[model samples]
Target: MADKSTEGFYEVFEVFSKRNEKTDMQYQFSLLAPNHEMALAMAQENFMRREPVIDIWVIKRSDIRKMTEEEKETLKRIDNKDYRLTKGYGYLKKKWREYEQGVLDENEILSWGEDKDATDRKRTTS
Candidate 1:
């Protein structure tokens, strides 16, 4: 009887959703349901009722290829891909400093949107 119950419960399904068509689907959680249709209906109301969801997927737990304990232990390497980030090119800062040139950083770029001259005229005339 215990084995029978375990077999029945093995039909657990995981729910996932994508915020938009371009975004990747993220796992919400797992729930037990008898069939795929029932799982999908329950997932929409339970997990995505409060947020934007353009796509949904219901996958059986058994279908997922999960990593073992040994794989997880070996996967904990440092993510030192400095070549992929601005931090890797930090030497450019010193090079620019030698030229006495200020870097056009994010703040300076955003400041270009401010119409300071217009605002000054409005303040003086008003």
Candidate 2:
């Protein structure tokens, strides 16, 4: 059994990380620390000891405002919003074909940012 009064001192901190400059931040894991400074100091050692991380963020769990399942269900997308999706932009492929130009889709466009040598090696192996 632990002291109830001291419980408040150890706050939960959520860790997020970005692998490289071009990558988006992703949730890594969680830890308990007395304060933000201590949490930040411990974050790298605790979560990224063996991994390459470009950036790390430590957020106090109590400070986050999240929606419930019911609140999430309220969010909806209309079929008329097809222009927002890749399927809606499918016509661009045919249009590009007409001009004899390549139409790079989302994955292909993103892959352009990857290391060309690594990509070439993978293609050769495949």
Candidate 3:
């Protein structure tokens, strides 16, 4: 039989905070409390006191359902971000020859006009 003095198990709560309304809530820390009110208060006092936060949230750890490894893999497969890399953009060797210019390089393509002088000026020998 259970002891008369024994209390129920304490619930774990995960805290999330948003610096501003435009930003998404980020995981901050976890706290164990007997109820939601206490959890929110504890989270606010323990974590948010030092940091600047526009909003705060507290959710029960048991309520959260995590994605499986297979689901993670599926997301990886679906996200085809090769175009963001060098190889995905393909080599412009022939095109550069046709235009009588050097092939687009990493710095050149990524510069976004910041290196306008380098790109526009002809090579000089000193």
Candidate 4:
């Protein structure tokens, strides 16, 4: 006997779970299900029953758009252009080092947001 509900059961679902408070969610594995509800329940027993899970996401495989082998070939570009990155800006680092100055990194730039005095000074000056 053919079951109509089982026809869609071949649909794949990707399962993910958050292990703890400090860590981000990671992919567990894939499972087959008739619908999202079934997939979620099955995923819990199949993978997360013994482990800690803060959150879960059951995504339908058909809904996901993944790159194909042919498409990946086109995604490749020349790595010779470091001119677009900080590594390309290595000369500036050497220049700053020569003057006994620290290389300006992302942490220093973001720290500017924490400086209320700098913001107030800018507002007063401008």
- Winning candidate number (TM-score): 2
Please provide, for model 4 over 1-126, each residue's C-alpha lDDT reduced to its tens digit, 9 standing for 90 to 100.
Answer: 547867755788999888778888888889888788899889877665577677888899889998999999988884676787777787987787777665577878788876977889899999
The C-alpha stretches of model 3 lying farther than 4 A from their native spots are 1-7, 21-24, 76-87, 93-96, 99-126
Worst 10 residues of 4 by lDDT: 96-105
- The TM-scores of all predictions, comma-separated, are 0.48, 0.57, 0.53, 0.53
* Candidate 2 Cα errors over 4 Å, as ranges: 69-74, 83-126
Q: By descending lDDT, how would the candidates be arranged? A: 2, 1, 4, 3
Give one digit per residue, the lDDT tens place, for model 3 in 89-116. 5667766677766457778776867676
Distance (Å) between predicted and true CA of 115, model 2? 65
Q: How far does residue 11 in candidate 1 sit from its true spot (Å)?
A: 1.0
- Top lDDT hit: 2
Candidate 2 TM-score, true structure as reference: 0.57
**Cα-lDDT of candidate 1:** 0.82
Select the stronger candidate by TM-score from 1 and 2. Answer: 2
Q: After superposition, how far is residue 14 of candidate 4 from its true place, in Å?
A: 1.2
